[model samples]
Target: MVTPTESIKWKRRPLSTMGQTYKALNFEESVLCSPTQYFKRYIPDDLFTSIAAYTIIYALQQGKSSFNLPMYWDTSLKVNVFWENISRDRFLELRTNLHLVNNLEKPPENKDKFYKFRPVYTAIRKRCSDLPIEENVCVDEGIIPFTAKFTAKQCVRGNQVHGESMSSCCVESVLLFQVLKSQGINAVGTVRQNRFGKNLPFSDDKTIMKQTRGYCEEITSADEITMCKWLDNRPIVLCSNFVGKGSVDEVELWNKKHHKYVKVERSEIVRKYNHAMGGVDLFDQLISSYIVFIRSRKWSCV
Candidate 1:
């Protein structure tokens, strides 16, 4: 049997035709294509193909030091001529008018915050449902930077980001976890210390490190869910239904006082968490690096 880690190695098949690419892009075509009395604004028939071409061109072209819309249209720069094919006004019009959900009715209670994104979210979930998931899947929270004021916006600290932001911790995340579980996929994720309601057996008399170590030992040994917790500057709780207690590993940490590398013991859970929780972070890093620095007030467009 193939191990979970080894299952990551898979072949990629090329999309053979324009129809395949269109299908991939238009996940909600069935719903969006059919114009209802309430939701009369259906997507333009050729918009998906146009958007795909536009995105490909945008990805290929390099931007100026201060990336802006004008740079692409400047004839002096070495830019793709594709921009000339589609007028800027037409592009803006399509972007402004793109509707996912019916704007005619009030969104259902408690979901007004994400109502604008609901259609795209549904499309994404549909796409995920069709794909074959790996044996081991990991879940983690991510932040989409939005400086604008919104009801569901969250504020995260210790990064370049500041002010209000939207978070990915929602019903969708729970649904994804459930879907993966039902498919017999092993899932793991980091949880906030305060959010984890379990009572730790540690006492006030014990040091933080000792308490954390004790908790890790207790959970790894006895937890029915195979859940575990560990400390790395702060507490990190994780749940893994398939992974059992694993052997300990050690790492060399630099001791500033002694001016030498000191060996520190690390739990198997910590190693696993580090390996599994980085997928979202890695994706964020890649996208942020090549981001087209266009200013848009619309959160959905950003």
Candidate 2:
């Protein structure tokens, strides 16, 4: 009989398969799309019966994201966390042994930084591409929660953002904007100071902040390219082939040190970016709300 380790190895690289009319697909994107999709694909007949039996009871018992495993195994009742359906040891073994892909088949070290989630991420990218393309679309990175220790941990994590990322100012310039303009597409986005034209320079955030909070600087090219920097709660720089500094309007901004909202002058360019960028934020918010929570160190499991 094949042992668990051997079985896992076999899964990582399937040696052979029984005769089939078509390739057997173990992992399907729709299965990961929704709870209903998951139940439909995996356990259609037993889905409702099992959920009615155990799912609601466990959910009512505790928080959705707050399952404590070590605590569950504790001998003391006062400190011990409990699950009605499974023992802690058994659950741990199940989690540790679970294999979506063979570790041996992982991409060479550093070649693919996130080899673990490649399949899931590729699937997500595929699904995102299948979505209807609009003239205005924004690409932002998605966050996958890792409760345990990891090397690539970052302080910031937000919604299920995914798409084709816009190039940084390093890759974006008057030349690139001109190309977009030639294609009848106007581009406007936030830029960093280091790569934004050196000949056309603006004061740093500290210098700008030292002046009136509404202070701003603008440089417009003969061909209509605009480079703008404004100081509000912070210094922000923007570059575009089309939009430039227009009517300055007052908007409320939270003054953190003062603990109140203060009126700050906002230019038309900033206002337009804020209004349009809402589409990206909305996309992230909607998908993030429905992400399935799987308790595993692997980002792909989520």
In terms of TM-score, which candidate is strongest? 1
The count of backbone overlaps in candidate 1 is 0
lDDT of 1 by residue, 152-180 (tens): 55566667653343344432222333344
Prediction 1 global C-alpha lDDT: 0.46
Give per-residue CA lDDT, model 2, range 78-139, as digits (tens).
44345555567656544444333445555565566556445445555555665555545454
The TM-score measured for candidate 1 stands at 0.54
Task: Flag regions of model 2 displaced more than 4 Å.
Answer: 1-93, 102-110, 134-185, 197-199, 203-207, 210-212, 221-225, 247-264, 279-302
Lowest summed lDDT over 10 consecutive residues: which window, candidate 1? 14-23
Model 2's alpha-carbon lDDT is: 0.55
